[model samples]
Target: MTAIKPVIEGTDITSVEVGNTTLKLKQTVSLDSLQELISAVENFSKFFDLTSLGSADEGIKTEWNEQDLTQFLSKETREDQIVALKVLSDKGEVTREEFLNEMKKLLKNPGFRGWDLGGLLAGLSIRSRTWGYESPYIKEERREGNEWDTFYRIKERYAPLIKKWLKERGP
Candidate 1:
């Protein structure tokens, strides 16, 4: 496993961790892009602790990062999001049918296990229309499959944040 540390390059560029790799990016950013970058950094700084992010539970975990998970899943919808992610984390490659069945079986909340639950399964694009939310994990494959058949799986770029979160939070 690769390890990275804080590197001060120019006045702007800050190194980011892409997996265990150190990505030192120094480039010009458009005004809009700069703003977005600042917003993202500010948002990411809220975790209070980043040291234990991907290392604490490395023995068994996916590539999904905990910060990214929290950013995508709101408290109200986190349970649903976790259920879907958990299925992918366990099965690796799966279809929407498998996802739906696993969700029905894993979702502990009675109110969220309704037939309508599948619609918000991934909060992804449906019927070829954008839903404004796409998981870094499997956004394209988990689509409602209006344009084509669906395929789902955990993203390779992410760390094993899902399994760690579930173990810590229960179910």
Candidate 2:
């Protein structure tokens, strides 16, 4: 990002974080008052060049791209993991049942009927023995109103990146 230095004296704007999901404005002023931050940014917004911003990781270790996807996933991988990535990247959010159905269809296995990937271990293919640290790409959350029913979601920023990559690197 092009750092917008405080040209106007007494302006305490320190940094501005631009993310795919949300734009986080960092400043020296108190965060209690959102209005002040809004006004402060409004005054100096013209000086900001948001075009060349940094990749929005959304807490992921690295940004999702074709190159990163290859390196990150090529090591010690699982078949289910790849299938899950494909499904989640396209679907965005899939409940346990929906996910299992997709898995069954993709894998072409009748045995997957009523089967479960269970915990993050299978859902994200978390291998403690490997460099993979509970995939930064996918999130597993327990669906409300059900204890066992969980849903998988590919982070919004990564969905399209994955979809594009998968398309290019076709089966």
Candidate 3:
């Protein structure tokens, strides 16, 4: 029998098959919905070693400051950064302006990094497809000041350097 090695990436899941009935899973699912999924695995257990399988561990971990304001948001190591941004954007539940304002505040902190920004931008790109008229990056910059006001300003100013980075590593 071939050893069934499982590899997980972000929320995406894949399974190797040594027998019939290939396994598959949708990356986008809630923890509460997992209980129902066990039935599927249980039925398949007769053929495969389901003993190694466990509950679906997903979702984010966010905290609030003593002042009752949000301090930080965190998610599973395997959780995609874009997924986290989607959660934040959903929870904020704001109009475009309000959302951008929130992003500006989040970005101003020294701790924010390119990964965070990329995630937000990527999420915004996805959300915009359905919501319409929301450019998280531009809006985020506006919140801080202007697209030319934030670090992106320098990025734009140094277009050649930015292009080099893009050429080496496409967005």
lDDT of 3 by residue, 16-116 (tens): 23233334443333444444554555556668674444322111122222222111112212134333343343443334434445455544554555566
lDDT of each: 0.50, 0.55, 0.36
Worst window of 10 by summed lDDT in candidate 1 = 124-133
- lDDT over C-alpha atoms for residue 101 of model 3: 55
Estimate candidate 1's alpha-carbon lDDT, on a 0 to 1 scale: 0.50
lDDT of the structure predicted as candidate 2: 0.55
Q: Give the runs in model 1 whose Cα sits over 4 Å from its true position.
A: 1-68, 71-76, 108-118, 122-134, 139-148
Ranking by lDDT: 2, 1, 3
Q: Give the C-alpha miss distance for residue 35 in model 3, angstroms.
A: 70
lDDT tens digits, residue span 26-53, model 1: 5433443555764564565565343445
Colliding pairs, model 2: none
In model 3, the runs with Cα more than 4 Å from the true position are 1-111, 131-133, 140-148, 151-171
Query: For each candidate, C-alpha RMSD in Å?
Result: 15.2, 12.4, 19.2
TM-score of each: 0.41, 0.48, 0.18
lDDT of 3 at 171: 23
